[model samples]
Target: MSEHGGDRARAEAWLGQDPDPETRAELRALLDDPAALADRFGAKLEFGTAGLRGELGAGPNRMNRVTVMRAAAGLASVLTSRDDLRESSGGVSVVIGYDARHKSDVFAEDSAAVLTGAGVTVHLMPRPLPTPVLAYAVRHLGCAAGIMVTASHNPPRDNGYKVYWEDGAQIIPPLDQEISTAIDAVGRVDELPRGTDWRVLDEAVVEAYLRSLARLPLGTARDLTAAYTPLHGVGGAVLAQAFAWCGFPEPDVVAEQAAPDPDFPTVAFPNPEEPGAMDLALALGKGRDLVIANDPDADRCAVAAGGRMLTGDEVGGLLAEYVLRHTDGSDRLVATTIVSSSLLRAIAAEHGVRYAETLTGFKWIMKAGTDRDRLVYGYEEALGYSVGGDDGVPVHDKDGIGTALMVAAMAASAKESGGTLLDLLDDQARRYGLHATAQLSVRVEDLSVIADAMARLRESPPGELAGRTVTEVDDLAEGLDGLPPADVVRLRLSDGGRVIVRPSGTEPKLKCYLEVVVPVTSSPEEARTRATGDLTALREAVADALGL
Candidate 1:
């Protein structure tokens, strides 16, 4: 069939089932607009490890009622088809959770209706909560599958749905592809059955989760004051309560951003790592001992200490040391993504803790500590941390709330030692040598540009960088370790420096992750100076190699 004709037919057919007047009108206009039609329907949104994320509008490309319902139906179909999943004393069960993004609540309800109508048992969170809460609930409830409605730190106009398997981690490999296949085969939305029998969970889950938070104390003084913000997200209230319940001083919340607003009026980008996104929190934290922030969904944590907003790598290194300081490294593993700084490896080795590097994301990191290994903590450079519970219950995802609690405790301990978090970082630098890292991201008007750049680099493989010979290049297109294959290229340099370039899994950009290490022979400051100089030159060389 002609692609344009198919788009027109699909749009006309969707109008028959679309219940929202706004979306229906939008689709009707697209039927006559060929370019708009093609843009919306030329390709269906592919469901991968990250699930579905896009702008909110009409048509197949946008996030709307029909797309969510179809995703729910597809997920329901997959879970019910698994014979082992159905053998539960009850029927196949799924848990649904959503954050405070626009249309998130409505999408959650639609999922409940579709899953219940598919003859599967469904449990819905009573309120919009953080992604980690949903991820924790999946394992805590012993459900066969889970869905979280959130875009994490994306802009306000966007929303998404992330799928979790029985392990409570995001779906990977054949599962994501399988769910995509199911979604592709879904019939019209009106033909799908909708029901209201699914269970809506009470505060029991939240109460239990808070109680679990109470057990994570590391003998740190609770004397530290933290300035905090939730970036106009739903995490503010829950996080505040969790800290108070844990007997820590009440954080000074950013009044303007304390409440949940779907528009995210306070920040240009809701992500904490973005420039100026933490300006309000930083301003409020000026006189405080620590500044703590969570991305809109509270699944990621960011902190500023001693008038310095620490990079994600620095926070990760501190947290890794904190975890290792408290526990005997026996049978416990600490992990980070391949793109993250190698400082964690130094700390882990110093404490005799096992360390593993996985493909980016907590899904792979979580598995590294599962079974006999038992992961005590894991983090990524994008401000995501998963601090394992000492009681053997695995969170299996990056948890901002839990990590925030630990960050507070870690800061308090540092204060008790008559120093700050900065002092602790210096101690690590002196022991493990200084590892400085930076990222070069090229946001493109066309995604094809990223593809072309990656192809060119692969074909012409640079032999040198920053006056140093390039020792090795691993074209990760084929796969690495036992982890799944990904479209990434990694470069190893002679001076203990490294670089990895890959297309972002979620955003439309090519990201270059660069890191360099220098020995701390003279002083911590000298080590930083040397590493910074080396990194700047490396950045230019890398940019030249990618023709950026």
Candidate 2:
């Protein structure tokens, strides 16, 4: 008997139901290779709050036609079982969208078919669109659910299936587990009923989403010269149209990445946070007032100004200040994640607006406040922002296109005042102290390395870091500060420096978020210098303690 004897049976079963000929051939080849067969069939991709994401391949463990089909059917089963949802919505319907990744359109089509076959009405996007558009469509079309086929900033050969509930935010908690259970119960892809009678949406859906952007409270100063890049993804055309519609000058887009290219040839990784990912865009931004880059699906926004890429926390602070000043709402709320800098909370306090800190990701950011308090603005340290319109949150997810418009508007207003974004940062420092932030990430080949490091810390935590006394240690897995339980640990120094360590939800990396707040007693520049030094020392101490 072979070591992969069980996997052989699973692989053969998967091969029989896989709809894609490419994947079927790959699986047939893997059958004779025991190692590859076991890898493909050892375990399935676990679906959770974020939905399914993995390398594109031919087995249950990888993201492929069969995997997507099972996920879609599972979601459909859950939606159909919701009698209350059907009664409230008149019927269960879903809006489906996809990006330009490999087989994204096919996956979208298959999802629509599966859902429709399961007696759920499907309104599918006419073409590949940004993930935010789908999020907005879920609410605009009054859908019970939404699905987007995109891996966001992942590498070329990766793809994903992201689920959004009727509230237009990513699914969370019990719902995710319920859908996962349904997926596990799914027997075979070929046996799952599929239909092609779903409705294909028109340009009206896209136009409606754009109209919501126009409602953003942008000032009249639209004289900003900007450079933009979509990082060889699907955001370029829509972002251009959004800028023009909002009365801003058309930005100088990087020619190499102006069009949607799934291969993402210009950069090693399509994500703007990756090293050298924005090199070309930054080069083009030399003489521009601002530079903007969006991830592949345009769900996250990154900005550069004065030839420097501003950290996500800086952008969040600026945008929070801008929105609070321009918009008029008595019960407005601003929010950030636990890993993000605490600057927004200070800004919120100054403005007397409600504030919250949630677990990382826009899913938590979007659900920051209660129904009484509207979420006027929310952001995370990972370049994701969800800014509310004049009415309410038009898109209840991270919208890079909407954020680009706001960034342009803010830049124009600042330029008109004869200052740059750097000046605004200095002002923020003087008013609210220098809240400097940095990150330390360790990418691992084996996931257990991360588990081992975490366990080591939990068992024997360092009493001090960087010569500062460890005033408090928060085991986030025990759920601190009214937030849900998470695989995270936070260390707070007596001097007010802080460190948070957690496994990256989207990648194979363990990350540490560092913050050092310094009072601006001297000049803002001097305070920044001191804060930077403290953060560096803190980073080194954390690295030594982790022993990774």
Candidate 3:
């Protein structure tokens, strides 16, 4: 048989046992089209960085019922295999949560059935909620693990399933591999045992999470007007209620993008970092004091304050300054990704705080914080932040709702004290050399393009950025600074200029992080001007090296 013919035969056999009527019908329709069939059944999806995320469709390569079932059973196998869990009377408990994305609820229910049938204790969230809520419940419920059915800020056509260890952080390294091996061992869906017995959690979990948000405020929250948009996500209603409970004025909401809509009709991309994603909120905040936005799953936060949208780095600096000033940040461990601006390290050093740099993603950043009070803050360049995650299980991940509330309180206090988030940023720049950051991301249809680019750069590394000879090239693949090996390159140029390039873990894009910090020799304004120019030049040089 031809390769395509073999694909058809395997797909037909698989379809005979597929329990989902939707997917079975979809496969049947594609049987007449060999190319579509080949594309769907070409290869099974490999769970990679950020768990099992892919376009939603009817084949193994896509996010469908069969793939998710195997993933759930795989995770269940790992959970039940633990000696401690198996010894327990009730076995290990697993909390499951879902966001208001396409088929997210279905996937969550599917996971519950598989885990329960596997004799694992399963508790499903009462309804669709943010991903962080699920992360918090893992430890809050004394469960051995947690599973969240969400694609986060991915496009409308995509969905994902992520497994979190007892630490409340996503599974990393050898464990993900173990789960993948178990998934490969899954038998036919019709033959698998799927019990209907499972627990649907009450509102106590949600209420307990609110108590943590309530403690996030430090200074006085004065009269402040704000606009909030969840970008047609699940964060709106809960955030509004939290604001009401926290004694803040009702925010002006972007009605069009306020509801939970899986279609995401309002924005091209559901992420606030994307251009035009915050347009509605900005327009609504034209005369307000602040504008806040959360992505689809609400695990990330984005804020526009004092009429200017703040970058994740700037927010990181301000939040660091705030948390440190309020608590003993000196003894605490604050962390940001290596690709993020170095301004944070300067801020930490100036205040006598211990700072650490991890590889991109919260899985690495979450480890930066140790005890509840000792290790305090974690953030990434991409709008992910964890302010109150010091306490275990409750918040082991980045949370948009809590961060947004904190931003509102910060804005109010700033307004009362005659300062803005933008002013605070300028102050930070003046204190710790004017640090400027920018990014250049290239999206591609074929992921091999990214792999080829990284390989080429590794083989023939660039020696300079914007005519400045690089002082050092830290090939992250070899694991420098006691960190896990990652496919990244860090180039240190003359002055405090730096450039780091890596393929994005979640998307099919090659991302480059650029930064240049110039001393405030004469004036802060002058330093900003020079640093911006240097960053622009740095981007061009890196783009040229990448052959973009």
Runs with alpha carbons beyond 4 Å of true place in candidate 3: 369-373, 389-394, 445-452
What value does the lDDT take at residue 355 in candidate 2?
Answer: 94
lDDT of 3 by residue, 409-512 (tens): 77788888887778877788778888789998999999888888888888888877787888888888989987899999988878777889899876689999
Give the TM-scores of the predictions, in the order they appear.
0.97, 0.97, 0.96
Ranking by TM-score: 2, 1, 3
Per-residue C-alpha lDDT of model 1 across residues 37-148, encoded as one tens digit per residue: 9888777677888999998988788898999999999998898888887776777889999998999999999999999999988999999998888888888898998999
Could you tell me which residue pairs clash in candidate 2? Answer: none
Local accuracy by lDDT, each model: 0.88, 0.91, 0.85
Q: lDDT at 131 for candidate 3?
A: 88
- Any runs in candidate 1 off by more than 4 Å, and if so which? 1-5, 446-448
Clashing residue pairs, backbone N/CA/C < 3 A, model 3: 372-390
TM-score of 2: 0.97
Clash totals for all models, in order?
0, 0, 1
